[model samples]
Target: MKRLLAILFFLAGGLAAELAHPVQCTLITASGPQQKRRKAQ
Candidate 1:
């Protein structure tokens, strides 16, 4: 039971990291379009 709990904890941590990475990348991508719009003005 201890081993199973440890594995689950490890998986949860990795999944959290993976999810955060994509969200950060998407925010940067979304902001880039606005920067271009501002520069045009």
Candidate 2:
């Protein structure tokens, strides 16, 4: 039972990580374009 629970927790953690990576990347890249515009000004 403990092993099963551990596996479930690990999977959930990975799923959460996978879900967050795209959002984090989007936020970083979104700011990059804005920064370039600011530099041009």
Q: List the residue pairs that clash in candidate 1.
A: none
Which ranges of candidate 2 are over 4 A from the true structure?
23-41
lDDT of 2 by residue, 10-41 (tens): 99998899887744554444434343345565
For each candidate, the alpha-carbon lDDT, in order, equals 0.75, 0.74
Among all windows of 10 consecutive residues in model 2, the one with the lowest summed lDDT is 27-36
Error of 2 at 7 (Å): 0.1
Clashes of 1: 0
Once superposed on the true structure, which residue ranges of model 1 sit more than 4 Å away at CA? 23-41
lDDT of 2 at 6: 100
Tens-digit lDDT track for model 1 on 1-41? Answer: 99999999999998898887754554444434343345565
Each candidate structure's TM-score, on Cα atoms with residue i matched to residue i, is 0.51, 0.52
Error of 2 at 2 (Å): 0.2
